[model samples]
Target: MSPDRSQTAYAASAADLAVRALDALRGIGGTAMVAEHVERAEDPKAALAAIRVVGADTFAPYLLADAVFHPQDAAAVTQSFALFPPPVSTPDPPPAGAAEPWLVAWRDWAMAALLARLAEAEPDGVRAPRPTGAPVLTDPDHSQVSDAPAGQGSDSHAAHGDGLPTPDSGAPDDSGPRDTDWQRWSVRMGQLSPLALPGLDGPVHSAARAAPLALARGATRAVLRRDFPTAARITRWLALLGAEGVALPLDPVPLLAHLRLHGGGPRLALDVAIARRLLGLETV
Candidate 1:
């Protein structure tokens, strides 16, 4: 099969898998097992390709809920990386206003590493630093979100109430140009949405903490443009902020419902389902 075909098969499988995971997340039906959806094939190459596509999110269910992390699942996620290999190491790009792709890949790996650690399977050979599962912005009991106050500032910096950069704003020195263009900024947040889960934090989460309204605005814009995938990704950030008690520019509840209704495919559905979990909207 062509790469596209593999992706098509994987996306359908992933989405269905996400639906099962979502059910598990809501305490309904059976637990979502990674091996079932991720390994529904005899073709090792295809399975590996699918794992690479979803990256760390392949273990999202385990992270989101108390789902068991069987050894096979851990080995499958680990083996896929060995088969496909990680990206070539790249130097830290100069502190810039926008996120570079390398940074996003590293963040993705951080999520995977966190899950690997939870599974107690120190995946050998992978190079991303270990992720501390410390709570960044999650309160397991958190379940409410509010709208931005009337006349609140909407610029990128002020989008975060109080207009202060969080502690882990960026590189150690915290020096370098910061991107203020909401368009680019929102897109980068969307790409790094995989980091929007509970129990993880860093530059990306810090960056997100600095821009709730911008993230909400970007998500609304994507919805208007019929770019559901982009909208859904940004929604993940919005959902996270809402959970963190940040006053958002929009309500995440209806937005999640909209995506569930119109966001094409299981992959995008997976994003929305994850967003729903972030928002604590535990229902069908």
Candidate 2:
């Protein structure tokens, strides 16, 4: 089949697989059975194939995360990279009003996490360098030198010098802080930036020690704006961080459920639940 047709087919199969996984969770067999089924459902290659079929769609990263966390298996983690291959170069920013931009961001963060896990598991394997050096912001319109009054843009640039540029950079500066904020948050989480994956030729443990308050602030703003998809996506990242022992400024579970209920669809809902469970949060 063609690429598009294959993606459509994988989406359908993944949806069915998610439904079965959810049912297994809800069934009398409980978590152990769910784990068994998740393992038995596909081997490494097949699972990777299914994940690739979905591409960067909303549920793909979540499925990969589930495979990484629940199975606690190296093969699952290794296969995830097939879907989230190494960045060839700095990626262009997401298009204006792109459908599910959050998913794209999530894929990058998820890959970074997977690489970190792999490095930890196998010290001799590939390892990524920790994010060091000043962040390099490259905006075509905004010169590397800030136009803002001295000390004003200092913190903005210092805090997220590596942030992805907003599509609406041409808009009035005050027009949409939320959009701008989300872009920076995505970059800080190593979304589009050049934070190389671990197990490649860099330092291990390179994730930023981002302030919890900043993450909470952006998530709250996304929630207030009724941008649940963005909120949910960010919350998912926070949960991933939390799984790695990072403390969060706030509990993202409630907001995650809210998004899952509002309109996240079955696949997204399953993804949210899986993320919560991985984080030791209640998933009811």
Candidate 3:
């Protein structure tokens, strides 16, 4: 297939898998009694590619709503990590909010860590394989960083004093938006929205903690510009903050409703659904 055709095909497959994952997220949130499984166990390569697109979100139902973790899904995720790995080398002492390369590796590490914890249940005698770049699990339910040092464990990005980077840490100014610039800041935040999930922590979360109002303002700006995707992603950050009990300047409930009305894709739907759960408004 030509590059264009290949890209198109991959996009279609990823979209379908994302919707299936969305269904599982909604179902586990009580929209349905049981969520649908998302792995294409028949075709490991296709499944792995789809999983790469979905990223850590493949486990949203299991992570967010306590849904059962099937071994097949875990195995697929493991395979993706090993086959389609994150960058092998990170910037030494990676800049906080480092660009795509580090973020990819960092997210993979967190996803792997979460996968390991979910495996502890071992339902039906199926234990998930540990991915190569995962962080060490220490109190999976809480504490974003493990006991390992900041630079330890696959550049999972605990580069500050503790596992969590301080809000005051140096910014990735050249690569990302500076906090003073809400417009560009929002775009960068949107890109890092995937990191906004519960049980995942790092520099981005610390930044959000310090600037809930900034995120809110950024979300509002995105909405004003009719950039629903960016708006929705920023809303996800706000929702995470709300979940963490950080006082948000703007109420996320109404913003979520707005995004639900305007957003037009399964990935956006998935973000909204997870945001609802975070805000204790899980009605699917």
Stretches > 4 Å off in candidate 2: 17-47, 53-163, 166-170, 173-184, 187-208, 240-249
What is the C-alpha lDDT profile of model 2 across 1-284, one tens digit per residue? 67787666556656655564555433323333223433765343344454433323322222433422343433444454544454443333323222123334334444444444533553222222222222223233443412110001112331433334443542333434433533353324422211222122222122222444445665676577675644554555566657667777787777776777677565556546555655765443
When summed lDDT is taken over every stretch of 10 residues in candidate 1, the lowest stretch is 143-152
lDDT of 1: 0.59
Q: Which stretches of candidate 3 lie over 4 Å from their true place?
A: 28-44, 91-98, 121-180
* Ranking according to TM-score, highest score first: 3, 1, 2
TM-score for all predictions?
Answer: 0.71, 0.49, 0.72
Question: Model 1, residue 81: displacement in angstroms?
Answer: 1.5
For candidate 1, lDDT tens digit of each residue in 1-284? 88888778766554555565555555555432556655566555665566666655656667666577677766676776677665565423313212233444555466466655766666776555532221122111332222111111222332333212323342232223342234444654576666777767666666577668667877887788677877888888888888898888789889889888884876677788788777776563
Clashes of each: 2, 10, 0
For each candidate, what is the lDDT?
Answer: 0.59, 0.42, 0.59
lDDT of 3 at 225: 67
Top model number, TM-score: 3
RMSD value for candidate 2:
9.5
